[model samples]
Target: MTIGKTPPRGETIYWVNGKHPWVSISDMVEYGTILTTKEKVSVNAEKLFGDITPTGTLLMSFKLTVGRTAILSIEAYHNEAIISIYPFIDNEYSARNYLFYILPIIANLGDSKDAIKGKTLNSKSLYNLLTPLPPLKEQKRIVAKIEELFDKLK
Candidate 1:
């Protein structure tokens, strides 16, 4: 996915104070869920950013904070710090819940470079990060088991 260009500061107020939720890296959580966000974008901003990320799209932050992941429960737009993953084919084999659980583990395997600023995972490195996928039934079972355990913990 291509990163959206940042709107100039002066124009941001108008472009972001509208109906669409605008997500930044700050909106992501290690727990693999995003409940809400503080920023929003106008339709024009959405146009500039390309398509709205659909509900249940998995989001991962690869820069700065590095390993944060989340699943959007609502339609939203996100900044460059995050990349949205949409499962277009074989939905049964690619469950969003399962991916959410797996992304943080993948992030740890990413190639990290220590620059003058901070640790970052370049797009190429991120693309090359390996992920394990089980059979569709197993994936669903894992997700269900995770939920069950979490519910117990709660």
Candidate 2:
């Protein structure tokens, strides 16, 4: 997991039709896939402000309105409120799939004192959260089961 980067608050980052999709908090969709972003920034702006989050990475918002998760369908840059989550393991796809499903729990583990407007988790809280990591096969099973139940919801 890595935090996304952003330009300064007043910077000129958005363009009418820029070279990179710039995913911000407003662009996120709960348990949805981001094929394209509503906003774009220049290539130079992306180079200066953020790194490219490759396709298939999971993103979760951590500031203001927390707990929204989205799968990246295109290579893009994101704002600081979002974090890129992808596994660095041999079974990359499986591990990431597991994390994507469990992110809502992690997002809600914030302190209760700030529950009125929803809790915002800082980087410290985010990294400190304990997540269950079963074996690769088990994770795949869990993902499959989750998808099965989700399909039933439709």
Candidate 3:
């Protein structure tokens, strides 16, 4: 969907209260990597806004659980309010590894406590989050180094 041409908020198909996965903001946690699923599973495409390919779309709890980002280690459906950011990487490119490295950066940024109901993260404020970008090559190197060190620590 083009930014300027995107449908108005009222016209867009958004996830409502009932359709969302009701998890506590504190329960939502971030991990360096998610365990891979052995069996293949089909998921609803509507839960995700953009591409649904595993490792392609990065899922983050953008609401009250801000900074809890996770890469789709396996092809699974996400709930509404989950901040799904998928870089338009073709089948040849994977952003999952990079997302793992960047998750820390996002988590450290802090979450907004002033929610509409004092229980959820304000989506409007979530969008204004500042994400630092590094060169592609540098990102790759950072991912590799982090992976190596984490492996040793584990």
Best by lDDT: 2
C-alpha local distance difference test of each model = 0.75, 0.80, 0.48
| Residue runs of model 2 more than 4 Å from their true location after superposition | 13-17, 90-92, 111-118
Using lDDT as the measure, name the better of candidate 1 and candidate 2.
2
Reference-based lDDT, residue 104, model 2: 78
* lDDT tens digits, residue span 1-154, model 2: 8888776656655454488898987787778889888778876676576568899889988877777888999999998879998677737589888888887776777542364565678878887777888998999999999999999999
152 Cα displacement, candidate 1 (Å):
3.0
Clash-forming residue pairs, model 2: none
How should the candidates be ordered by TM-score, best one leading? Answer: 2, 1, 3
The sequence of per-residue lDDT tens digits that candidate 3 reaches over residues 31-123 is 533334322212222343344335444666655455666555444444454655656542323355576567546644645666574334455
Which 10 consecutive positions of candidate 3 have the poorest summed lDDT? 1-10
Predicted candidate 1 versus true structure: per-residue lDDT over 1-154, tens digit per residue: 4443555558865465578887888777676567787777777775577778878778887778777878788888888778877655546535667877787778877898776667778889887988777877888899889889989998
Name the lDDT value of residue 14 in candidate 3.
43
RMSD from true fold, candidate 2: 2.3
lDDT score for candidate 1 against the true structure: 0.75
* Residue 7 displacement in candidate 1 (angstroms): 2.3
What's the true lDDT of residue 2 in model 1?
46
